[model samples]
Target: MSRTTRPRKGAAHGDSRPAQAARPSPPTAETVTPDGPRYLYGIVRDTAPLDVGRIGLGIVPAQVYAVSEAGLAALVSVAPGRVVDPTRAHLLGHQRVTETLLREHTVIPVAFGTVMASEAQVRALLRTAQGELSGVLDALEGKVELGLKVLWHREHLAQRLVLEDAQLLRRDDEPEAEHERRLEAAVEDRAGRDMRALLEGLRPRAAAMREHPPVGERMLLNAAFLVERPRLEPFEEKVRSLAARSDTYTFRFTGPWAPYSFVDVHLGLRDEDASLP
Candidate 1:
């Protein structure tokens, strides 16, 4: 799923990195600005301080780096304001940061537009949530998220079903509309069964699976799988086999992505003062 290398054994979960002592000292008042809020990307366990790159959102893209506390680190950048707008560029920047980290670490992605007042607030968050954060990090270690979608040409499948099944054939005595309703029901049943079979084939390869509502009538399955790094190739192979087995349905596959759907922690921050749309 990812061409990026994995961390050394025990590194992804946690290491013996000294906590706040290893982190860079906070800027003195004379050199620091008054209202420079921190825009958080995500968190990883027990890593030494790192500079991710210049991929943050703003008038001028800011440099992203880690702030450590209690053996955990948050990837953050100095934001232009307290309220970072969720514009296309900004959202992509946020996603890029997380995806970049996912290449080497199991990221606990924070909510989009999460901004704290200063390094103190960010470190405070890591310090306060250390136990909960560490537990989630352990569960997600060495895994990545992948997405799948299946869609079909409804009219084509319906016609084929009618031709193949005697029960599905239109009767001269049956009204055209009534026959159409029966065809719709048959398509729904068939799609459901097919979706189940697809999931069953790959379920054993995943640590966790999430189902999203299909977007259109033609779409039958929309799902995400949390797969271990070692199992990635096999998981992808299973998907390919399933797609090849069905010519009637169109399959779309994506990702070696950050585990956006898997992390369940809430930061419980209040943003009442911001003018976020």
Candidate 2:
């Protein structure tokens, strides 16, 4: 490969060399340009003007803003590379912006670190997903999602379940030592029945529900519910009722937030410079 030298501003026509040493390069894999890609936050209705402030990820100070095409609007900011680093600062920054949008508008939360090469590509995405995006915005209107994670105090809940259900008694075929060693598993066998009952009890209150795999050992249930604004109070009451029934459990509940789990549109674009390889 050959490198070409372009003259600096105000330099003579034939004088192209710099008066100083060349700048060192960034560590490998970093995008080395000011204009690499734009990070997407989410899609919002474009009917009203947005007052999003300057707060998005990048080495440069970026102003949060909107770009629209074919009746779709995306909230985006300048990105320093093809993908933003998944560090805590970047991830939390993305979340805080989405949290801010929930206060005033219906947002179709894009996955964190979503990036497009330029404003043109952002417009192209809007055009490609236009009809689907519009329909999602409509369906998600006046609706939000709530997340619930229920965890059992592993030892206490297992003991409680075993005490309540005679069927959970250690089997005659099972070794006494083994049953004593893994009493928690014996407890969970019965607890699964109660958990199923809890699921059935909560299903009627949600417009839609998505269950996630538990992340850790003590976690029993991880789920999100898409709920209408009008039913928000009823949903809260139901959650409280469920919580009341579980004396040996813990619940971490959040939201009344943007319908993040409910939106079906996917922009699975991995790279803007598709020709790079």
> Which candidate ranks first by TM-score, i.e. highest?
1
lDDT of each: 0.76, 0.67
Tens digits of per-residue lDDT, candidate 1, 18-99, equal: 4544465334331155645888888887565465778877545667878777888888888767777888888888878987
Candidate 2: worst 10 consecutive residues by lDDT? 11-20
| Candidate 2 root-mean-square deviation in Å | 15.7
**Model 1, runs deviating above 4 Å:** 1-22, 25-31, 269-277
lDDT digits (tens) for residues 1-277 of candidate 2: 1111211223111111222221222222222335457788888666544667666664343567777665656777767678678887677667667766766666788877677888668877877776777777777765678888888777787677678777667898988887776686776665788778887888898888998899898888888888866676677778788888768778777875566667766564455532100
Clash pairs for candidate 1: none
Q: Which candidate achieves the best lDDT against the true structure?
A: 1
Error of 1 at 269 (Å): 4.6
Q: What TM-score quantifies how close candidate 2 is to the native fold?
A: 0.76
